[model samples]
Each structure stands twice: as C-alpha cells, then as structure tokens.
Target chain A: MRSKIGLLVVFTIIFIIPTLNYAFAAGDEPGEYLDRRVVIWNLFFRMMVVAFTIGAVVSGTMVWLVWRFRESNPNAKPTKYEETGEW
Target chain B: MSEHGNWAEWVYIGVVCALLVWVGAEAWNVERLVEHVPADAEVIKVTGQQWFWSFEHEDGTKEIGELHVEKGKAYKFEVTSKDVIHSFNIHDYVVLIDAVPGRINIVWFVPDEVGEHEIQCREYCGLLHYNMRAKLYVEEST
Candidate 1:
C-alpha cells in the first residue's frame, strides 16, 4: 500500500510539474513572432499536458485498483472455461 | 469493497476539478491575447482562394504570395475566403483566423521586429492544401 501511494505521488509529480511549468511559462512578453509562437506552442503544449494528465490519472487509478483488490485466491485451481466453438 | 467506493468518488471529483481549473486558466490567457490589438496600424484585407492568398493593404497596394507591412505599427488583417473555408495561420506569430466566405474574420498584431513570417492554410481545402502558403515581410519604416 505504501509503495502504491509512493508510485502514485511520483507519477503525479512527474506529469503535473511540467504542465505547471508550461502553463506559467507561456509568452508574457511582446515580440514579433516569438510571443506568437509561444502562444501557439503553449496551446499545443497545454493540449498535450491535458492528455498526459488524464492518461496518468486513469492509468494510476487502474494500477491502484489492481494493487488494492487483486486475486488473493492464489491456491485456487484454474477452471476449464475455454471457448471451443467457432462461428 | 464498499469502503473504497467513497475514495474512488473523491479521486474522480478531484481529477475533474483539476481539469476544469486547467482549462479555465488556459482560456483566460488566450482570451487576453485575443482582446489586445495595437493601434496606429493599417488594415489589410486578405482573401484566400483554393490555393493562394490575395492581400490588399490600406494604401490600396495589392499583392499575391507576399504581404508587406511596416514595423512597429499594428496591422489589422481582415481575412475571408473566395471558395471553401480556410484558416489563415501564421505559425511563428501564433495568429490563426478562419477564412470563411461572406464573413470577415479579423486579427491584428504589431510587428515590432522586422523579419519574414510564414503563413499557412490550417484548414484542409483540397488535395493540394499543403501547398497553400504566403509570406509576411515586416520591413523597417522608410
């Protein structure tokens, strides 16, 4: 449980830190193309950040759930539940 | 299992809130950029056809493939299209305005520095949409 929490925090910081930096580092100065490019790049960057954040959160949740409630019946024998009929 | 359900709900809410905050902050920043247009600039009417751009400056100077503007002056670009909808995007300046027929979309910026900026058609109009490009030349005031 502690390891899972640590992993979640590490992943969160790794993904969120860059997004925070990018969000704040967007152009604040006035220049010819520099500021404009920064703005455009910021848009694309933010989109990426959002995607990464969502992915991290979803995957993290899945990992947490798997770790928390995985199959504890280690001694149970495998049942023959194969599908043999073909269409 | 039911004990963890509340925790899951909290995590879901937290994620949603974070996303909302992120989107809101970005929207505010972009809105600020869009609202501010410098004064003392000329107006240029840019019309996009199938594969080219037509530029008309305030001084009645017309050109194709190249646009010229004086440095340090704000230039208002009135963008429209002749055929299908196209987006006039200046990648370096981060200016993008959709060019639609019968409607004028306006974007303005001051070219404080003198250089050549590349303009591209952001919307896919046809097979040769990638070939649509124009140049913006910012020259020192004569």
Candidate 2:
C-alpha cells in the first residue's frame, strides 16, 4: 500500500507540472510580448518545477525507505509466550 | 503460506492508477481559445486601471460593469493597462492575456456560451489588487 501511494505521488507531480507550465506560459501576442510578462511566467514555471521535483524526490525516498525498513511479517503472530509457574 | 495475500496493496495500486489516468485525461481535455474565436468580429479595447477596468467596444461604444457582444461573431480584444502590469483572465472561456502598458496585446475569443463570466486580474498589481475585477456579458444578437 505504501509503495502504491508513493507511485501515485510521483505520477501526480509528473502530470501536473507540464500543464501548469503550459497554461501559464503559452498564448502571448506575437512580437508584442512584454519583458515583465516573460519574467513573471519564467519565475512561476521555475517555482512549479522546484515544487514538483521536491515532491518526486520525497516520494521516491519514502519508497526506498519502505523497501529497506519494512517489517518482514507485518501481520505475524507474536511468539513470545510467557511461562506459568503453577504448571 | 500465501505469497500474495496483501489485497490492500492491490487496492492502493488501482486507486493510484485511476487518479493518474484521470489527471492525464483532464490535461488532454483542456480547450484552446484560438479555435473558438471568430475571424471577422469587431475589436474591443480594454484598459486596466488601478482597481477598475474600462472597455471601449467596437462602434465607439464605451461601457463599464457589462461587456456586450453579439453571438456567433468573432471579437478581438486589444488589452492594455493604465498604470501597472495586469493579467486579464476570463474564467469560463479559457482567455488569459497579459495587459501591459505601452504595448497592445491582441486576443480573440468568441462567446459560444451566453452568460456572465468573471474577468479577473491575475497579476499582483497593487494594494487593491484583490479587488480588481470585472464582468463579461455575452448577449444574443445585439
């Protein structure tokens, strides 16, 4: 379950990053683009890239941690039985 | 003794796959504004002030609070600003254009869905930036 969740996070970031950049960057009038608009769009696109990269890195790290540290038998029955003195 | 007993893992995988597919479909379905705009409609001049928008439609008609257009016709917008840089974004029609000073930005979008749409300033202009907004009313036949 944890692995699946991690994969989901990775996919979501991949899907959202391009659309956000395209929506914010495309469709300016030809030869009339302003420096301010270009600057703002570039900044916003960089921010999105940073955010998605961080999310992907975190999810990937979590997946690796789960693979390395997860219990071998999460639903195992306890075997540390106590002895009765009367018996 | 069972090697594949984690049904929860399968469920999680299914959910994640479904969500990814959904996002992909949504990204694919985003509509473009250029295809909907007409080729031969009148032009409108939009100028953004500090906290208000003033529009000058074709035929020398000046109006505020309401932007009227004839249905089934193409309309072009020449957007600019009076003071600072502002982004003109219409929520429903996928029309987003930057309105800058000393330059005219041309955008063409048709109103196929006749109703009132909200026009907002997407860029952070000034102190009253949050309150800068306007309306676009798509009317039938003039």
Candidate 3:
C-alpha cells in the first residue's frame, strides 16, 4: 500500500539515513584511539549494543509469552497439542 | 512460511533483511579499514623466529626484540615467520596478524600515543612460546 511505502520511506530517512555515515566513520575520534584501534573499537561497541538489545528483546518476549500463555491464564487458547494431549 | 498472517511476515522479513544489510555493511567497512594500506605508510618487516621478534625498518635498520616507531605515523608491517606459525600481536594498537612460514601477512596501525607497548606472539610456536615477546616503542617524531 502507498501508506506502508510512505511509512518505510519516512522511517528510513529519520533513522537509517543518519546511520549510513557510520559505515565510513572509521576515523579520528576524541579519545586515545585515532587509527585502526578506533575502527575496531567502534565495531566492538556496535556489536555489543546490538547483542544486548537483541538479548533484552528476546528475553522480554519470552517472559511475556510465558506469562500470557500459561495454563492458569483463562483467556489463553488451547493449542492443538493440548486438545489432542499427545505432545 | 508458517501461515502466520501477511503483514507480520512481511515486517519480520524486512527487519531481518535490514539487520543483515547493516551487519554486512559494517563488516565490509572494517575489512576496508584494516586492509587498505595508506600510500604514505612506512613499511616495516616483522619476522617471528623460534622465540623472538625482529624488526627491519624502511631504512634497513634492524632491531631484535625491540621495534622503534614514530608517533602519529602510519606503519605497514609485513609479517612472516622463520619457523612454525606464530601470531604478531601489538595489543596496545589492536594489531594482530598471523606469521606463517612461506607467507607474508600485512597489517598496519598508526600509534597515537608515544610510549612503550608490549608485543607478543599469540600463537603457540615452540617450547618457549610463552617467552616469545618484544617491545614496541612509539617515539615522538623529531
């Protein structure tokens, strides 16, 4: 849909476009690192950020799903395995 | 494609694709940054022997167990080994490259700090592998 495409474009412009420069940002920063060390450190920091974010997202999702789909939750629907009692 | 609805599937695919693209781009950037040697970089030959590191500067100045370089200058190291495999690592500058027999590996770094840093072999070579080490002195450019 046009609305979906528009939203994607807007999201990319606001978020993705700004970060595109990071790919070429392996240069002198205001610190002890100014060369290859800076590039490697940036990579490590970025990877850790992504790792921690993904870890939190997965853990939070698992906790919410477990609580929402517990057997004690009356609103939880019975899975086909539960109905068949075979799994 | 579990029949997990339409919009959810598309959004999931888009997010995964975006993440992959970003990771790939970052990887390529790092590769370029590490591999692209500067034209003005000073070449230094780093030789890894049984249990010692030797350096040969561009002016043919040789130093054993000690490498003297200037601060704020880019240096390209042509690393190789005389015996078994070894790893040339200068942890202060995050420079790590393999030293394989019959093969030369290239790595470069620009030292911003003018001080003495420890260099060591990260790979096990021989009985004295633990003692295989050197010192890197980054002197201020005169």
Candidate 4:
C-alpha cells in the first residue's frame, strides 16, 4: 500500500511539473501579432491547466479507491459484479 | 486508511471548486479579448471574387491580386464576396474574417513590420479556390 501511494504521488508530480512550468514561462513579447496571440494563448493555457487539474484529481481518486478496496484489505467488502453479456 | 481516503476526497473537491472559479473569471473577462475598430483607422474595401481579391483604398486607388499599406497604421478591411462565400485570412497576422455574398464583414489589423505577406481564401468556393490568393505589402511610412 505504501509503494502504491508513492508511485501514484510520483505520477501526479510528473504530470503537474511541466504544467506549472508552462504556466509561469509564458514570455509574451510586445508586438501587434504577439499581443493578440498572447491573449488567445493565455486562454488556451488556462484551459489546459484546468483540464490537467481535473484529470489529476479524477485519476488520483481512482488510484485511491483501488488501494482502499484491494483484496488484501480484511475489512473491505466485495464489489458488485455485473455480467458482461445478456443471455 | 479511511481517514486518508476522506482527505483525498476533500482535496479533489477543492480542486474542482478552483476550476469553477477560474472559469468564472475567464467568462467575466471576455471583453478584454474583444478587438474594437479604432475611430481613425484607415478603411480599405475588399471584395472577394471567384478566384481573386480586389482592394480599394479610400482615395479610389484599386488593386487586384495585391494590397499595399503603410506600416505602423491600423487598417480596417470591409470585406464582401462577389459570388460565393469566401474567408479572408492572413496567416502572419492571424486575421480571419468571413466574406459572404450581400453582406459586409469588417476586420482590422496593424502591420508593424515592412514585408510582403500572403493573403489566402480560407473557405473553398470553387474549382479555382486553391489558386485564390493575394499579397499584402507593408511599406515603410514616408
């Protein structure tokens, strides 16, 4: 369980590091084209950050649920099973 | 372990709230992104035909297949189509405005450098649409 948590944290960091760098590293110069481009690109970058944040949260939740309900846990109950095909 | 799971859920909730706030801020700031035509901007009439573009200056100077403008000045292009719908696009300037028949659409841009830029029809109008293009020359101000 500790190893699983460690791996999940590492993966989350890997996903988040570059996003933070991109968020802060926007070197928009002063020009007619660049000024207009920066406004659009800033919107795109912010949207990307929101998307990545949502992805990280959802994926982290999935990992946590899996770890919490693993077979080795004595107090965890069995998950409901559904048949794949209809007879 | 149950406590840890609860904490993780709280973190996820916080992240979602932050995302919502960011979206709201962006929505409220939409006006800053809108580009308005200046009152003193130079007006140039542009007509997009089947396979070529025509430009007319305020002084009645007409140009076909090429447009000339002075650098460091904003130009408002009033565009319309002669036959079918054609899109006026300049990749270097990132200007894309649709030209529809019987309707006029205006777009403005300022060229800061002196060079020749390619003008293209983004929408497919006819068989010769691939050959529909023009040149925009930004000359140094006298």
Top candidate when judged by TM-score against the true structure? 3
Highest DockQ against the true fold, candidate? 3
Per-residue error for B61 in candidate 4, Å, reads: 1.4
How far does residue B67 in candidate 1 sit from its true spot (Å)? 0.9
Which residue pairs in candidate 3 collide? none
Docking quality category of candidate 2 according to DockQ thresholds:
incorrect
lDDT tens digits, residue span B39-141, model 2? 4657999998797888997779998755777665667789999899998887676677888999999776656657888999899999988988888888887
TM-score of 3: 0.75
Q: TM-score per candidate, in order?
A: 0.65, 0.51, 0.75, 0.62
In model 4 chain B, the worst 10-residue window by lDDT is B27-36
A1-87 per-residue lDDT for model 4 (tens digits)? 999999989987998687667544533322232234456567868889878977898799899889888988776865444243332
Query: Which is the leading candidate under lDDT?
Result: 3
Model 3 lDDT, full chain set: 0.87
Looking at model 4 chain A, report the run of 10 residues with the lowest lDDT sum. Answer: A26-35
lDDT (Cα, tens digit) per residue for candidate 4, span B33-138: 3355656778999999999999999999999999999988878899999999999998888778999999999877778889999999999998999999999999
Per-residue error for A14 in candidate 2, Å, reads: 32
lDDT of 1 by residue, B34-86 (tens): 54554554789999999999999887989998998888677789999999999
Candidate 3 or 4, higher DockQ? Answer: 3
For model 1, the local distance difference test gives 0.80
Instruction: List A-chain TM-scores for all predictions.
Output: 0.37, 0.37, 0.48, 0.44
* Cα error, candidate 4, residue B78 (Å): 0.3
Poorly placed runs, candidate 3 (over 4 Å): A1-34, A70-80, B1-10
Worst 10 residues of 3 chain B by lDDT: B1-10
Interface RMSD for each predicted structure? 6.6, 12.5, 7.2, 9.0
DockQ, prediction 2: 0.04
